[model samples]
Target chain A: MNKYRIVIEPGSENSNYWKDLWNYRGLFYFLAWRDILVRYKQTVIGILWSVLRPLITIVVFTIVFNKLGNFPSDSGAPYAIMVCAGMLPWQFFSSAFSEAANSLIANSNLLTKVYFPRLIVPASTVIVSIIDFLISFVILIGLFFFYHFIPDWRILFLPLFLLLATLTAMGFGLFIAALNVQYRDFRYVIPFIVQFGLYISPIGFSSTIIYNNANIPDYLKFIYALNPMVGVIDGFRWCILGGSSHLHIPQFIASVGISILFLFIGIWYFRKMEKSFADVI
Target chain B: MRNPIITVENISKSYILKHQNNERYTALRDVITNTAKSIFTKQTIINNSKEEFWALKDISFEINQGDRVGIIGRNGAGKSTLLKVLSRIVAPTKGRITIDGRIASLLEVGTGFHPELSGRENIFLNGSILGMSKKEIKNKFDEIVDFSGVEKFLDTPVKRYSSGMYVRLAFAVAAHLEPEILIVDEVLAVGDAEFQKKCLGKMKDVSSEGRTVLFVSHNMGAISALCSTSIILNKGKIEFNGSVDKAVKIYHNIQTTNKNQVYTSQGINKEIFISETYLKNSENENTLAFSHDEPVYVVIKFYANILLDDLLLSISVSDFEDRKIFSSEVLISKVLSVDKKFGEAILEIPSVFLIPNDYKLNVGIHIPNLQVFDFIENICSFSIVDNGSEFSKYVGTDIGCVFSQSKWAII
Candidate 1:
């Protein structure tokens, strides 16, 4: 009974927010489960689309950059394998970021009707993206077998990079989702970010191309690392290609710092705007 | 005495009603242009379009355990805003509410139901959205399915379901929620009449189990049948809060007084017009309120500029919710053979015919099936008080709109 006692006042929810999140964990899982189930319901290919999207993209990148353009593969691993490794995290980040950004408006009915942690909506969308990430990861395993390339002990550190990518996606996702509720203009902004981020971040090609090329200045590389996906993709390549792939410690730290910083900023802005979501949305 | 399970203190909510050319949402382009205009023209454009409207103002109330409280109000009278504040869907602009025990609010049926999800899946999903634990939903799964009567199509997606089946399935999940307090909006308005009755009965059972229930509905019959106490809200303030009978009576009075008792066609030019209309008693005195056992007369005076054949005058008596009780139609030629240029039509509704409630009249002059000369909706308003009739004793049970004097014998 004491656990159930609730005091509701203007902005009084801040004190019980995390506890509410913990209590509504069931709703969190159910929403994620519902989205996953519904996503594949009507389509014939269904879940296989997750795998096909990244596999096809990586194949095109390999042909365009490696076979046709004669670009050097800095990692020394097969260009297809290197591209596949980076593509997995990039796909996960883009899909997760976009889906989480629009999740609040998509579930506006629930926003106005029920009392739960509003964070659950965007958080659940990230989980859906994680499922897609896992499905596409299957392609990476297939690439490994086709090339007969064994990843070294560094491969075990892959979960650490995945966690970093999740944080980066969530930070941006939560920020835009809350802004979308208030300004609705952010809805158009999200797809643009995804499309632009895909090109700016190192996914189809390697980050080493920019670092090793003398024509590109040092400050330019620093600005490029500011895009958190640069670090995430580079980290994935390092884990899969082992010691041969250069993990630039300075750029890596810069990216990690930015990811954590965005996470805090996103959460701060989201919490500030969450209480008014029902009214404005 | 048991302590009150819920205590609200001077709660108020105000919204900034932005007059943005009727757009429901503000666009960034508008904001940017407004900012640019302000900078260039040296005038603030945003403040002129903003006005603050208080949906609720300084409302205070307390409810003891096991109380069934009904909230009654006209449209936009802050009823929904109050519910949203109490349910924590939206925070009040000021003040506090302290509540004991687990509280669940069903502001709408099928709130989070996915159209493509199976009925079985929706039940689980909806149960959690309503604040039930997964295990709790699992335990009540069978009962929900059985109550909804959708056992044969449990695996079928709800998009394929008939609307009746969908509402039932959604309501079944809500009904099985075992919260200490339940707040329900006008969800009972859906489904068929028999299902509505069942929902009222189920709510009564929940109240009997020592759980608190707060209901908002336009159906006065449902409110009287289920709620033990009631609150009447008028323009964001509490007008009255006490026994259900008194609250309902106050609501009835509020409706009639808000409109005109005597209706007249002021500035309209028509072929036929109802010049004046009013309700009168036996002594030929005009009145807007009546007891259940008193005969009432609706007098309508009309003048026809051009005499024509096939003129039918209809007087429809409907409740505040616009549910028509009955409409009486009279063909002018069949009833009277006098001059058709000027006439008066009087409708006598006998004693014991109407139940105790507020009602309005819609007077229309039209051809039998062709055209309408004049149709005035809510031409006048009237009320029939309880008068301590036999139906008054069954106040917390469904007392239908019409009264019957038929005799019954025990077998």
Candidate 2:
């Protein structure tokens, strides 16, 4: 009996897996298309549901938060525009999180039975969510015209902000997806995290509320920006609204640092959990 | 002719079976007691016993270009683990493996086929998964659809296809993938008989084109027909790695010897226990012997705890790989009288059906729709040595499950 054992070794950052991902890029497109098709399959309105979902969210938030709670918006931008801008990143993150968390378990048939780069699973979810983000962007443009808000040169940073939000979502999404393969409890915890994340992030209210309150110190303001979405939402508001709520340099720096930190940590944790995925999943 | 396509060294893999502890937080009282115990003794308070299982154990083999090798093993014998390590789906715990060419694996049918996608779309999707380029897949698109026989359903979503159609399309894409090396598991078990025959033919065509093939299957008949060499694995270790006939013989011997001690009966009425079973030559020669296209007989002795009625004698014949060749049940309701006394019964297998190969016999005594009285599975094993029969020429080698004598005239 030859006692051969496979010791757990950490994967190097420069392994061929990245190159494999590149080679399997066509698979990424196919899976993204499949996700889009499956999402609208057999529905009465089909692709309209993609635009209608976020549009309905904007209307409900405007009524409940703006009309009743009296939530303050940016200086000149209407409440609908502010909510739509905030909703963009929020929807992208939540949708990406839910999709990626279920990616491995949903594709257990493939994972257990086949040999492909496992990273393709979560990577495809991020791609699929980007399609949804683009569809919902039409409503954002509609609100932009209705509110009569003019763009600034800072609007060029919209792609940068979208990339940051994508990285953050994929970072956490990959880790949670791998963990959910073993500990099924993460499946139940993910929806709660997404819903709770909406209230904690400055989606419904403006980040200016944190600045105007005197009870908090200036140092705490820098710490508050550690939540990566604060800078993203602020950047979106700053870019789209073109108002006094400009990007705070410290908050932006904090956001960039935290986003990178999540990206690295998420990859590390996900790679650690990947070894057991084929068996347990 | 070319460089060795797959060079697998001493590769091994181990898996942790269970988690030891899952508690996130410990009580203060429990922590203080554990801390005191740890201070007094080197042993920890928590008894964490981890069980590690090595799925593959120091297996080393090399496959050359154009070589078709069949890997045969029972379940949990590390066959899939070895393939996974070679394909880089799972890293080997110890040792190393190097391959010189692109490898495509059909470990399971419909592996990357998204049900929501159309069959035409899934063809490109599965092709790319096997590492074929878009242009290559497009060039072979019509051929794939024609081979799968799903041209009418090309635009229909694959989720709507029956399992047979799905497997046909999936296998077509994988079989047509023009990789330098092809690895396939027991995916042939899913398709219908005709489709399975088509897959076997395609595999033969692939291997004949100077491409390497690594096949894993329990069907010894298929392995013997298709592969030039074969390896047999047992308990995560290679038991035999040589000629397909020799490997099949070793596998069958081990299987029969292992099952000789267990007895089980089901779906019969009478209460009886099969005391023992054995096979001998027809002349009472005392040694297991039979010739190709000759009658083979088995003798079963047993004692009945209670008398029974409507007794039926059933026997299942399987090849060296434990794949069932044929089965028959002898109902004694009309042909013969039921003997209520403790005695022996002899079953005879007629000639010219089973090909020249090793086989095992499973015998059972059952009543009509009541319960099994006495049953012995794999009770006796025998081998049919070939003697230059006419059917041997069509098989190319004495390597098929059935040997039927028929003449073909090209009129």
Candidate 3:
């Protein structure tokens, strides 16, 4: 007789979960592919929307903050370039986070009808963000050419910063996705988070403005670093706008530590709530 | 003997059914306010009602290799819950299920098909969602399209396809899946009758290849045709587990309505009233169970305070779903003189006319298209058992409820 392939009992889902995730990688890829395909299906703009959204944001922020407000670009990089650097990572974080937050409820039909790692649903939404990020990265390359700004060896670390932004988004996205399944109020809560997150994060202005100020206290700076995206935006500017955009190693470490902690917390809470998702959903 | 392919031991699942409100979702405000009320008031909230309803309780069963098992039950009987547990869609609240081979369950068809995706894209997307690897779907791609007969529309988005074509494409992809064990829950209920028959035929082909199949459906015809062994669930517990015939028999017994088996009319004032009604076999013995080859009679006895004329006595037989199968009527004046105060009517349903299923009998004596003198619906019920008929030799052949021997010559 063949050996027993699967033994299912209460909490058996925890055992071999990572291995099951590995086995179901095809589903992960297909789910991501499905979202990517459906994202731009009927729209005439199609993939161009990915490029246009961030470009328009960069143009509008440059006018409001750089041209009108006359904010000093201490990095010696063009004010528009500095804002573009911050805006790219911020766009990726906001969209990926929001998408991941609603991923579970959006795929509730699959949750009830099929059995695969529930983690795949939210994780796949991140791929959509990655594709959008790659598309919008083209605009930043265009800015580099227009400004004749030659990048240095430090630019090789851009992927590491992108990875940071992804981890940060996924951490909060998974937590919010699971919570949204039980309490639909989280649905209303997500747009508010994305909206409020844009202003608080150092997107329109530089983190250096606050860190360089003599009036702001150290404790306030530390609390600002607690927002994981603050580290991601700082990292992006350090890599892309590399003149005077200093990477604060101490604050960077603090932010990275919090992002990892949120990732674990998100996974822990997601697994805890995953068992009842099919039933409740 | 081959080892059991699936061993389920004491598996159970329960859900906390909240009766506080009809809302399916919780709001943060409600949770916060309820917490505040509970913490400060120090008294239990009257409106907070939580009841744990066990959908499956201490159920245990083992299925061997190459067995086609049908799970038959009324609604709310936990058949779906049991399938959900076995397939690992939802974990059982207690106990365990050990399976020896790859199992794919179809609680629904087209589970993750995106309407905006083309038919070809959805095939791969849905196949992977059902646990098929990409290479496996690619290998079976042509066969799936051929089976669905929607090859011409492969490039078109599925939203544009007709509903029939959509279901065909979905079911075709599912049929090509080569799992060692397949668990399906009423996915065959979709599509037209011919499509349903085709789906059942494909399922039989799957089981014939020595794959274990667990099927849950309310359609007894499909159940009897496909499954060799069956399990009957009642109120979240296994009521019976045995051959398909006996399982279906027990299922009918469980579904037997709350109406009195031997209906006795109340003394509602009328010119005439049915006093008693029941079913009897060919031997004139009172039996609710009858063989498919034997005649069953509906005996209704009524009392009239005054002589009546031109009374039409009708007996209608309906299947388990309450669909009227056929009705037989006789004019009391033509059969026997209605000048007497007491009269008895026996409607004989001939042998081999009704298939193996539970059927209800509605007896009424009424004027043509006018007032009902004495009428009783679902007065009695009876079942026709399959006792190794010639058609029983073949598996998965659904000869519908009504059958009769008609003269035929095949050259």
Candidate 4:
């Protein structure tokens, strides 16, 4: 007889949890596909909303921060393109974070009824966020053509920061999603976090502007690098804006460190809270 | 000896039931403030505390391959909790469990079905949710659609399908799940009777293939019909574990004994409440089972905290099907008043004219037609068996709610 053993004990982590997650990869596919398919089933502008949102946000930020506030772009960068570059990562992070955060409650039926890894639900939500990111990235290509600006070889390094941005969003998403399962008021707190993050994350303006300023203290600039998105947005600007917004090596390494930290902590917290999800969700 | 397919060793589940007044949906704001306050005062003062309830208490059982076991119990008797623990939906609070094969459970039909998805898409979706790989589902795709009899509308979203069609499709996907062990809850109750029969037959086929099955249901007939062995659960403990017949009998015995004295304090007005209600034989001794000829008395005890008048006592009898046979007051024309403010009142039936069947009692206290003071519906139920009376001797004559004794002549 071909025997597979499963032993369940109180307060003991299943040794096969990661293996089981791999085994249930099919469930992950279906759940993500279902969310994407059902997301705009009845809407007229379905997938277009993905690009429409970032386009509108980019326009608004360019007008308000560059034209109205008279903030100068990096020496070689266009104001609109700089904001668009930053908006790409910011939109991905915010959308992915909120989607994963709400995933458990949205699929509470599946959570309570089935035995697949609860991580699959939020992970799939993050996948949907990635899809939206890809769609919105198309708008950035259009902006490049409108400005007759061809990005330099630094664009090749874009994937690294994109990965960083994804990990950072996923890490925080996992943390918030697990917390949302217990304290539902996070639903109200997410918008506040996203909105508050918009101003602090160097999205509408350039981080190089902060780096180039002589009046600001060096310690304050170092503290600003603590935001994981600082490196991500700086990377986006460096690649798409050419050499205008240079990557600060020290701050970039710090941001990468923080992203990895968030990734590890998020997974730790999620797995710790996962066992009780069905009981309390 | 072959290894058992499943073994549960002293598994228990305890649930913290929050009070209705407390917000069941906990918010982060409250948790944060509460923590901050507790930190400042070095004290924890919960405004509305919660109670811990043991849904399952040290339940242990083992099932060998091909053993079709049924779990019988009353509502909230931990039957569902046991299945959930075994399915890994909820972790056991204590003890351990061991299994030797792939187990697929359907705690509810259409568990992960999205009404917005088409039937064909949902088929694959449901199958994958139940642990079937994409390739496995693809292989069984035709069979599943065929069994559900929904091939014609496979492309249509399930929300448009009739409820029966939805249930049939859901059950077909679930029933098609091929696992070494199958665990099913009372989800069978969702399908129609014909679909239910088909499901039972399908389960039998699976067991005949040397697969183990654990079925939980309140339907005694279904339990005894499908399972060779069964366990009875009462108040989170296994009361009996033996043959299906004996286990079901013990279950019924438990229910009858446990439900004999039913009391309800949930009423519109707490001024007068039905504190206790029970069954009694002609000798005025309490009993749950009665004879055909023996007079049965409904012993009612009530308590009034404040002075009351024009208090009416009434009872309405219903057959096993919950059809109200008749309802009458103590006296139709005269308004009945409480003689004793707090005491027992015996309403005697000189001779039970009812056929041999179960009957439910609905008691009420009212002030004539002005308003109802207290009313408890289906508070208690009792069974009457045939005692070889001329009318009772006609076996299978439990056709009506009330038994009427009348003289019949040749003319």
Candidate 2 stretches greater than 4 Å from native: A1-14, A218-220, B1-3, B19-49, B258-380, B383-411
Interface RMSD after interface superposition, model 3: 1.6
Distance from true position, residue B48, model 4, in Å?
8.7
Q: Model 2, A4-63: lDDT tens per residue?
A: 111222242325657767877877777776777678877898888769988999999999
In candidate 4, the residue pairs with backbone N, CA or C atoms under 3 Å apart (3 or more residues apart, or in different chains) clash, namely: B353-B403, B354-B403
> Please, what are the lDDT tens digits per residue for candidate 3 over residues B1-411?
568999999998998877876888877787888878988998667345878899999999999999999998889999999999888888899998889998998989899999999999999999999989999999999999998999999999999999999999999989988899999999988887677768888999999999999999877767877899999998999999999876765666566656457888764877777888988877787767776778998888877675556777888999878889898888774444445666788888999888777788888888787778877787577878665454543324456767757788999
RMSD of candidate 1 to true structure, Å: 8.1
Clashing pairs in 3: B225-B396
iRMS per model in Å: 1.2, 9.1, 1.6, 1.5
Off by over 4 Å in 1: B258-353, B356-381, B385-402, B408-411
**Once model 2 is optimally superposed onto the true structure by TM-score, how far is the C-alpha of residue B53 displaced, in angstroms?**
1.9
Best-first order by lDDT: 1, 3, 4, 2
Q: For each candidate, C-alpha RMSD in Å? A: 8.1, 9.7, 5.4, 11.0
The digit string of per-residue lDDT tens for model 1 on B310-401 reads: 88898899988789999898876354444556678899999988987778899988897798888899767788876546554344355777
Best by DockQ: 3
Name every residue pair that clashes in candidate 1.
Answer: none
The docking quality of candidate 2, as DockQ, is 0.14
Tens-digit per-residue lDDT, B182-290, candidate 2: 8898877767767777888898899999888899987666776778888888888888889776666567656546444323333255456555566655566533446
Worst 10 residues of 3 chain A by lDDT: A1-10
DockQ-based class of model 2: incorrect
Model 2: chain B TM-score relative to the native chain B: 0.66
Q: Once superposed on the true structure, which residue ranges of model 3 sit more than 4 Å away at CA?
A: A1-4, B46-48, B262-350, B355-379, B383-401, B407-411
True contacts kept of each: 0.86, 0.22, 0.87, 0.78
TM, every model: 0.84, 0.78, 0.87, 0.79
